[model samples]
Target: MEKPKEKPIIELKNVLKKYDDKTVLQNVNLVINKGEFVTLLGPSGSGKTTILRLIGGFEWTTRGEILFNGLDIKDLSPHMRDVSTIFQDYALFPHLSVENNIKYGLRLKRINLPRESIKPSIYKKQKNLQKKWAKEAKDAMKKLDKIQAEYEKELTKKKLPKNKLVKIQQWLDDSDFKYASWEVWPSLMNEKFEKKYLTRKITNDEMDKIVKDVIKLVNLEGHEKKSIDQLSGGQKQRVALARSIVIEPSLLLLDEPLSALDAKIREQMQQFLSDIQKKLGITFIFVTHDREEALRLSDKIAIMRDGVIEQYGTPKEIYDYPVNKWIANFIGDSNIFEGKIIDNDEEIISILDQKIKYWSKYKFGQNEVVDVLIRPEDIEIKKSKGLIKGIVETIVYQGSYYMIEVKHKQYKILVESASEFEIGQKVYLDWTITSMHLMTQEKEKNKNKDTVSLNLKLNKEEISNE
Candidate 1:
């Protein structure tokens, strides 16, 4: 799909929001570029919902700037911000039909969107500019003529040569010489339209065309007249999406929209949302606790904890290279080893007490205390020569695979495999070189700040001696 992306469409800078005596959000900073699918992945009460409300202008930020398209939107209302949200409950009208529910935003009472008129505003400006431009152009030409005559008089008085006149007419002769283009005037954008498509200004034909197009986009073409009570959970979800999308918002917020659907239906809607985001090429911010759903639907992921973002990166980066033990425990399943780096090599690291050789994808300093992470599926238990000896402590059957817990001294390693090993059986634990993830502890990671290099000036004595 062709995504006609631009610079950041929404920015929340140092945003702090509080509800009465409680602070739900604090020092939240984020930038969402155009046409990117971003997910806010975290558990409940992590301030994901609060972020959406702030972006939608439903709730104002207590202490920071909310910018839309590089301009501060502190005074813009929800209707003027051109943002749309689909909530967890779908938020459809129970008494209305699917078509009417889709039309709810167009209805005068529900959303009350103002109409956008492009031509009349631009055309009026163009007309006024044309009138204004004529006098300016005439005055400029007259000034040029006056300068030319003065130069000629100077030339006659001083008896100068005709060859010195080349630089005087540069501006008059240059067609591409730039004056402030009329397009950038403060009045170019129409304030009366309110960045909306109103019901009153739209004719019945235009309204029907717009409503039908959005319904077709949501795949509700034949079920327009069907009542909301008559539709399935998936259909109702789509109706909610259609209602939000019909207004053509610059940013779309989805707050656990598939929480009500069955597993299979929810999976289907995940793909549906991804496809729609690509097809529409609009910035989509999805909020959900489901890790798999967020990984599957978003291009970037922001993981939050206790109303703060713990980490933000691509899904693969979050899964493979978690910053701290807390994030490793939250994002996916893994076995962790707490040991000091005894020997660092080109491709391996030896942990002294563990008597185990780690398959290192990163280099660690000698004697550095760090954590090593290995996914459960990466561990290979077999009779072949292995890195360490382990005793199988427990076996768990998990449908497609069996999870085996092995105890090696002070560490308990988890491994996932198809064959179940007997409990208390001695087995060899081994893993590939590329599968191990080395991480710095939270405090250590924070201590590694970005530094800049500078060039020093030599002293005057040294310079004189040189």
Candidate 2:
């Protein structure tokens, strides 16, 4: 049985953004499903952030639609849409404590009530009654706490009987005073406190629970009272996250939120962000230039370049089978070989007079030129006889593995091996035929258009195969 498809929470349909004569994004089409962590990944000036701003309502699209829950939200203001944004700088209130910062958005938020159902006279009466009840409830809670503490102390000193203790516990449990302010005060005051306010604003007690939950979610429980300036970089980031998520937005836009942190903090925050997203189960559209970070944190990655999404897929798909040579190099280290199809029947390609067999979903005509990519880790280097012989030009230690650059004929190939190899030593290189990936070549003229079209086509094929 197949699982039902998840609904898309946000979609960009041929979205284009322009500032004066400079075009920021052109023909951008993307879909972010609910509860998926999608990353807009690219180098600087690739318009990744521009797409984020457009979806966030910080910027408007020049010639396309931005959809939220399948409806066009191009005209909706940032506050009007159920979306939140966290910037790189954390955008926290320096003077405000973490709790206050998280509460800020909820305080400004309003819930609509039916005016016909709530009369102004009745509303005013309930407003006063609510305040009276709130005070009474707080006083009752304090009395209950004091009484319970005194009883507990007496019991600890063996001055109170066990029968008395049991009766007291039962009485306390049965009373409304046992409930927290958020859980009990509202009902005691008015069954519908929201209707009491003409402006339909959240009550202080309601906002308190929301802020508290979000603080705990981001792991900033003990630091809620600390000012923004007192927080470390990661803590400040959590505060920013809590503030944005407190309003319960349908989508969260994070623009390089961890870029400002140092290496150790950045990695810690990445894990923290991933955990929080999973716990909340909200759509997160993150933007970052760090390829490794994107691979680690994203369920889907949109690789943007020159104001266009070059490819959009899972990290493994983009890394193992990029659409073009540019993406292959940009995504990760690869040994690329320019070749031509020698025999279409056998799927054979000629690379530097060496015939290599490869497999690809896309077919090519005989004599058609193509590019073959094999990752360094995919290639195995042996000191004995193999398919091809080469001289080890350079060897660099990369913690777990050694990166050996082997010179085969006039071409240089990289191999990742756990065994050590000496420079200028004779070595042989080999890999399974399935490890070789064929990619489309980029054309200088109409490059972006071609890349986008090919990417769409390739993605369609990939989906069909799946």
Candidate 3:
């Protein structure tokens, strides 16, 4: 048997958020395992950034639990949470030099919290756990989970009563100790002792070492003395990243950090960020509206729409098997249509005299209408003998390759070809059976706005005179 998958470093369970009367996010569920590069991708106002804020503890869910290392962290504050976010606007201290900014979080002194203000719900046991019971408590918390999982499986097999199920759930939620708080001085004489104990700061040598190492990590070793104003946009972005990562947070959130950079620099930073994530083995939750950027950088992508995750999977899965027409159009240039499947075999699929062939992953009845999507690059254009002949409408010279638009009476197809083809030139467009993606016909009927599907419906009568 295969080994079980490790638990997520951070998890959002049915998270929902509301701003005044507006529900920004509803029933959001996401899991990010350790060291995984996951991206939340969507257009603006789609709530992708809101998800990052939730993970960073800058925003809280209106309902549902946020878990860190299997423990519920619904009550954790921004500083208390072990997460760092790099926003679009670097958020660096204007007066600090790059070296000081990178070392800022690491050299921070202890946060002075009054003992009474720290509630049980907002506390971590590490701050106050007794020395003798600390190890035992930690082991128990970790070990009990696996044991409970096994027991739950057995219970499911036995089909236990509802009351027994409740009992098991209660046992799982039970904790040996609750709340974490700062200790107060018992008497006037002990006040100085409390200040000494509570006030903690890193050594000068340690801060120096961390700043030096992180500066090197971000490829800004020599430029450590430079202020924010002295650095370029990309350099400033690097400094922001170094600051977030130097403290070694379990999860790193990047909210469109590359948005301000030019295309070339953005590409460079993309590779740099990905390489760093791999080298450090830290989980990255990147947020971006640029579909290509998400596809290029993320190991897994969660596509959001109007505060909900429309689909979540690998890039290949999302590309080859889009769950809907909207997703098919968003990621790439696709030719989507409601086509009729005529036949299964060679030329037997001929209708009237047009032997058009389309590939489908699912088996549908002959003569059944279905929704199909095929990428422009997937289709090959041939000057001579090809699958379907069409009149070239236009040719776009795209640096590396030519994009030729072909019109076949009612059908318009886009093909990425190596060679250039002139306007009104006759060409053949072809694709392998696997290149076509199919969706439900009923869903296609629901499309009110024909976006990608519009390229095919131009008036042939209007073009006849031309």
Largest lDDT belongs to which candidate? 2
The residue-by-residue lDDT of candidate 1 on 1-466, one tens digit each, is 9856548988889888888977777788888889889999988898999999888877888888778776566555455577889999988999888888877786542334433534467556656655665656656656656876676566555555556655544543442222222222222233333323222355667678789999999889899988889999999999999998887787899999999999998998888989988998889999999998987888889998777887888898998888878788888888877767767764345542544566655677877878778899998997557888888999999999999998888778999989868999999988876677888866633223432111123455567789
How many backbone overlaps does candidate 2 show?
Answer: 0
TM-score of each: 0.73, 0.76, 0.73
Per TM-score, the best of the predicted structures is: 2
Clashes (N, CA, C under 3 Å) per candidate? 2, 0, 2
Model 3, which residues run further than 4 Å from truth? 1-4, 77-80, 109-201, 341-368, 441-466
User: Which scores higher on lDDT, 1 or 2?
Assistant: 2
Q: What do the candidate models score in CA lDDT, each in turn? A: 0.77, 0.85, 0.77
Candidates ranked, most accurate by lDDT first: 2, 3, 1
What TM-score does structure 3 among the candidates reach?
A: 0.73
| Residue 446, model 3: Cα distance from true site in angstroms | 11
Error of 3 at 12 (Å): 2.0
TM-score of 1: 0.73
Q: Which residue ranges in model 1 land beyond 4 Å of their true spot? A: 1-6, 77-80, 107-189, 193-200, 343-352, 355-366, 443-466
Q: Please identify model 2 stretches exceeding 4 Å from their true place.
A: 77-80, 110-200, 445-466
